[model samples]
Target: MIVCVAIVGHQNNPLYIQSFTEGDDALKLHHVVHCSLDVVDERVNNPKKSGPMLNETYLGLLYPTENYKVYGYLTNTKVKFILVTTDLDIKDADVRNFFRKFHAAYVDAVSNPFHVPGKKITSKTFAERISTIVKAFGLSSAG
Candidate 1:
């Protein structure tokens, strides 16, 4: 299951962060997300010389803790999307799909005329869409 989803800005500032797990794990998850940013930066700066992934946005699984796995996606505009999931055996395609849908939702949210760039996302519609997306995670690609 997905425990957290975060959107970090180009400057490494957090644009949005939401936790799906219960209890006080939110702080730990936030720390995990923050730490993953360094990895993202390193990957973006020092990409592989040869491979299809050289220009791909999906960074795949950044790192996996004993209890959770972190995945990252970087947009052409430099926005970063983070996903923390408890499922250890998840497929790469599933993670990619999740990021794709999540990214689309994010784009729609920020497209609002009232949305100030770099500001925290506070739209109820965005929250609802995110909630729906989170709940639907991994369900579509099950085969």
Candidate 2:
């Protein structure tokens, strides 16, 4: 069975949420969201080779009014990762809508891909399209 976990935290803080599947050495996955690129990069690239290492990827989200941005990371159960960020002027509504669409597309695209692993998501058009959808959803001004 699949498990769903959600976490809520300040945009300026480190946020983490995890879920565990059932089986032998089942997936112990964790999702961490941070507001700083430097902090996230340091934690992911730290040389303290003790526990499992994470496979990382990055994405960027942009908001054109507030001069603020948000970065995200989607990691594997064995510490695999996907990182993303916004450019600037990011509004809360824009961020929320982006995740709503991004999460939907992830379930449809990534989960359905027949590749092995370590595939990077570098589609700027896709990101932009998603951003447009977010704006169309009336979330661009809700905040």
Separately for all candidates shown, the number of backbone clashes (residues 3 or more apart, or on different chains) is 0, 17
TM-score of 1: 0.95
Model 1: residue 63 alpha-carbon error in angstroms: 0.5
How displaced is residue 85 in candidate 1, in Å?
0.4
Tens-digit lDDT string for candidate 2 (24-108): 3213222222223444445556734444434432223311114223344343332212223223344545545445565565444
Worst 10 residues of 2 by lDDT: 1-10
Model 1: pairs clashing at backbone N, Cα or C within 3 Å: none
User: Where does the lowest 10-residue lDDT sum fall in candidate 1?
Assistant: 134-143
Residue-by-residue lDDT tens digits, candidate 1, 33-87:
9999999998988887567769788999999899989999999999999999888
Candidate 2: residue 12 lDDT (0-100): 26
Report how far off residue 81 is in candidate 1 (Å): 0.1
